[model samples]
Target: MRTVDKTYVIKGKPETQWLLVDATDQNLGRLATKIAAYLLGKHKPTYTPGVPMGDYVVVINASRVRVHESRPETKIYYRHSMYPGGLKAISLRDMLQKHPDRVIRQAVWGMLPKNKLGRRLIKRLKIYAGQEHPHQAQNPQPVA
Candidate 1:
């Protein structure tokens, strides 16, 4: 009887990549989806469902991200407290001003998996309010 090997081989080194995305005048939902894909390694051929093989994403000018139609007023972000009558809601306009980065981050976060690996992938995302960021040392490639 001859023994055969059936183990799968995993090749290639996982290098840390830095990517920059300009959010100026970009649609919120569309941009978030792209960012989430990059953070989850969905754009790579070697992507594994449960592995953290994503890249670092730096989003600039998050304050300029836009939403279509009356979403600014109609869209409501909800939050609740453990106590009764503690439900809270805020409009998209308010959210953009108060926590601009959070708006985009939350959008992208929702598109990712609801697991430990997803949490780790989120750590690679960086959102900035202005055009300038502190990741210049990483030489992030500009996504055009």
Candidate 2:
């Protein structure tokens, strides 16, 4: 049964807003999944597929996000520069120490659609390693 809703026929774009999430002492994966949902607009009743209906998410205290004890030593992030022997790896502990924001970003990315729309949606997310964010002027509402 295919039901067409007039609301899904967006003319250009839909209303969007900024949301705030605190990552202090929160689990890395869990926090990321929550953020991904907001970025995908799954939290909204007006969500439409293949549309950039998500809201902007501002995450603070990224450096304080945590993971399981074993993961710090066992988890290894990998990347390649496209050249032979360009493979590189970094442990979770090292990643957190150097680029905490990337940790959350990658985690959330893994949960996204992995397409052009996904790329655009990711841009709407803002992350900060510290507690202070310049989005204070937006007066972003705290996510539950």
Q: Which residue window of length 10 is worst by lDDT in model 2?
A: 4-13
Candidate 1: regions farther than 4 A off? 1-13
lDDT values, one for every candidate = 0.90, 0.92
Model 1 C-alpha RMSD to native? 3.3
Tens digits of per-residue lDDT for model 1 on 41-102? 87877776677778999999999998987899998999999689999999999999998999
Error of 2 at 103 (Å): 0.2
Give all TM-scores, in the order shown. 0.88, 0.91
Position 34, candidate 2: lDDT: 99
Q: Pairing residues by index, what is the TM-score of model 2?
A: 0.91
Model 2 spans with C-alpha error above 4 angstroms:
1-7
Q: Which candidate is the best by lDDT?
A: 2
In terms of lDDT, the poorest run of 10 residues in model 1 is 6-15
Writing each residue's lDDT as its tens digit, candidate 2 over 5-106 gives: 665656777888999999998999889999999999888888888888889999999999979999999999999999999999999999999999999999
